[model samples]
Target: MAINPDAVGTTGTPVESSWTSKDSLLYAVGIGAGTTDLAFTTENSMNIAQRAYPTQAVVLGDASGAFANIGTFNPAMLVHGEQAITLHRELPVQGSVVTTGEVTAVWDKGKGAVVEVTSRSVAPDGEPMFDKVMSVFIRGEGGFGGERGPSGSRSMPHEGSTPDLEVTLTTREDQALTYRLSGDRNPLHSDPSFAALAGFDRPILHGLCTYGFTGRALLQGLCEGDPARFRSMEGRFSSPVFPGESLTVRMWRDGAGAARFSTHGGDGRVVLDAGRVTFDPA
Candidate 1:
């Protein structure tokens, strides 16, 4: 069956998700954190406390269940188009949350369709913890004559101006393997044969993994390594990144508490674009 544009506003049952310090540490390492990032990678270090990466919230809950109401489509043809997250408060190293997911929008793009889903997580005390919006592009699922949706504006760096902050980080050859441990075990990221069938030369890194790496750069460069200062981040995935490629994140400050950025692969291709970040003013 084709996608159901009328599925917008369909909400899924609340999902209870929990994690531990070990889970957070594994996620830190999965995204390329090292000994230098002891606060996130270690639970017990001299005078260092364990901290969860702000982006960890993406994996802390299950929201994909909402997609069921969006109608059937080829799962393998769906690719992450964009992702955005808003953190209402700092994430604890180990915690639980009740998350509810909803189908927000579905846009037809002639040859394909874009489905947008939003999820909200609340702590046990009923305080909102985080909200995530994800868009997925499904090939061969369009042509139903639905609305094309809004074309967002770009957030580009100023002409003749250098980026305010730039950081480069390298991913391990086995990066996707480690990252898969964090609940996303899609064979396209670990099985070479499956990846071949998917049209990739080999297993490609998960776009969310690359997003996690970019989030690390933002946390360090803009938020002073404090998760509490990170308010929101959004970006589009323009291309696939191999597991071992180096990523360079370039940021342009947009006055206090706001910034624009992009992440490029080792070959200078824009892997993540139209990046936008907002932070709590210092």
Candidate 2:
């Protein structure tokens, strides 16, 4: 009930964030990358140059600071609703950035409220590096009679057509533990007792971890394994995925430089939907 609709347009002070080669390597392995993906998983693999994943931009900066202006709400009742990232250029193995975050929108959905936050990051030289948009749904924070907002259309694969690319990856049982080291350390992804208190039977995987995995598929499948060619990706979190689940990302080419995708968990349920990715086509 403390949700501040007026929080929209409020910006936070710029914060400097930095990361190292080891951080990038850890992120690659956290997202299920392995020896085969040497360029990302190793910094000194005999002639293999280290490169940060395009999606790693999401972790290089912290944007949650702007949430303070959004007013108080039960943290346990909040869940990631949607995520998006745009990379102006490929990330370096070690780099620093200054990020400024803002509250872009707040929508009332009757049963809950959805808040959209955006962060813009710039390299030390003042060059734009990446931008991130994150949406979170807070249960019981709605019904204030505010605007309902636009209900966007879903981006699904062409009817009855097979996916142009399908990459299935299995997450480790300790995936959340590794991903947590990057920045986010939410208890819902690690503490079973806390998860149960949040109505989950057990700990669940971080939505961003799933997003990182899906981004990997898009990079290899559409960008020819080149991070520089990967442009932007956006998707909604439709369901919860437990650790150790197999994720199958099915991508369908939409046009010359665009693709639509959905990720299904091992149970065949769509864990990520309305996915849209754009890259420099090979």
Candidate 3:
């Protein structure tokens, strides 16, 4: 199967769903939030804060099934390459929301097609919540006579100063299985034989799972464990992170409530790079 260039502008049907405090708490736990992260892991704390983890939006914005109707690419050949989210307003702990997505671009990389899907999420009252852009690399499905490379996907400039904050979290061996409950049940993150067929030695962590840990690092190191302080986050996937490995997120404060950051594994390999985070102004 290969990418269908004609599907570039295809739009997915709007999906309406609602989440509760329990769902939010489960998502936090799926991302490895611990007892200390009460705002995310505890409903009582969430009731008082009335906020959801910024990364939780990824779950709500998910358009995985929607892609099936717009592309012919083999699932085994796809890799999540980059992700970005822009928050327009803080998300409530529990609410009804609607999400709609479109295939915005299908640029042709030499080895694969880079497909960009942009989704707009809104509250039931029609309040715009956030915008999400997910970039996927479909191997063996390029050279379709599309644009040669990605556009407007530039990497973030490095943060040269010493990091003012750092947090390291080790993933459990069954991390992917645990995270799958949060709604992304992609076999690439589990199913060893399927991972092997896809050229990975073992199942790799979901890119969003790693994103969740990164968000946790930001919240803990900078936000004082406050979910309300987190406003936005974005990062490019640089390498696959195996479960049970430790990830260290290093962040440099750009100002009071903004920072540039990156994450590397204990092996010193960059896992997520060109990261950025924003918080409600102090």
Candidate 4:
């Protein structure tokens, strides 16, 4: 399936959705937040304040339907390559939101097409809450002879002395099942048979789930467990993580209130790379 270059700039129908406190708590649990922090996973705790994980923006917008406009591409051959998210305001535990998105660019990569998508969500009051730019690679969907597209800025490796902090999260065996409740019902993360056909021993965890865990680590390690301070996060998916694996995220302070970090799976493979997180000092 060759990608249609014309699909670029195509906008999708806007979606209106709402979520509650329970929804936020469940998303926190799905990413293993409850293991070490009560603030994110538990509904109520004596010492910790309940809050929504920042990475939940990926679900709050839910722009998967918009991608269908880009022409036919094998679902099994698609993979998330990169993701960048910016938070304009702290996410509420319960609120109605309006999300709209558009295809930004499509580049031919010989064996595939790299599609870039940009989506934004606004609160019921029409104030921007968060925005995300995602890169998805569609395998065997290239060769239509299109432009190579824009190049991402180079991410600098971690510098300075030892890591300022580290956090480890252990995923549950059914982590993906719980994560799916957040709205992404991709078979690759749930259906064992579908996963097997996709060349996995069993269903794999959602890359975004790991992304959420990394975000949680950033919040805990540097942001004082405050969601309001989380400003932006960007990272590349380097490898897949199983549901039951433990991931360790090591962070190095990059600037005033920013850090460069990476998450390593239980097998010692870097699951996330070229990661950067920024937070408001105030």
Best by lDDT: 1
lDDT of 1 by residue, 1-282 (tens): 699999999999999989999999999999999989999999889899899999998888889789989999989889899999999999999999999999999999988999999999999898999999999999999999999997855657663478899999999999999999998999999999999998989999999999999999999899989998999999999999999899999999999999999999999999999999999877
Candidate 2 lDDT tens digits, 25-72: 999988989988999998888988889899888788877789999999
Kindly list the per-residue Cα lDDT of model 3 for residues 1-282, writing each as its tens digit.
667777777888888888888888888888887777676677665445535788888888556545855567677677888888877877778887788888887888867888888899888789998889988888898887778864535554655667788899988888999899889888888999988987899999988999998988888888887766777888899989998889999998887789999999879888899888888765
Q: Poorest 10 consecutive residues of model 1 by lDDT?
A: 152-161
Assess each prediction's global lDDT (C-alpha) against the native. 0.93, 0.91, 0.82, 0.86
RMSD of each: 1.2, 1.3, 2.6, 2.2
**Model 3: residues >4 Å from true position, as ranges?**
44-51, 62-69, 151-156, 159-161
Higher-ranked by TM-score: 2 or 4: 2
Model 2 steric clash total: 0
Rank the candidate models, highest lDDT first.
Answer: 1, 2, 4, 3
Name the candidate, 1 or 2, with the larger lDDT value: 1
Given candidate 2, what's the lDDT at residue 231? Answer: 91
TM-score of each: 0.97, 0.96, 0.89, 0.92
Q: Model 3's lDDT to the true fold?
A: 0.82
Candidate 1, lDDT over the whole model: 0.93
For model 4, residues 33-150, the per-residue Cα lDDT tens digits are 7546777777678876777888888878766667878988777788899999999989887787888888999998888899999988888789999999999988898888998776
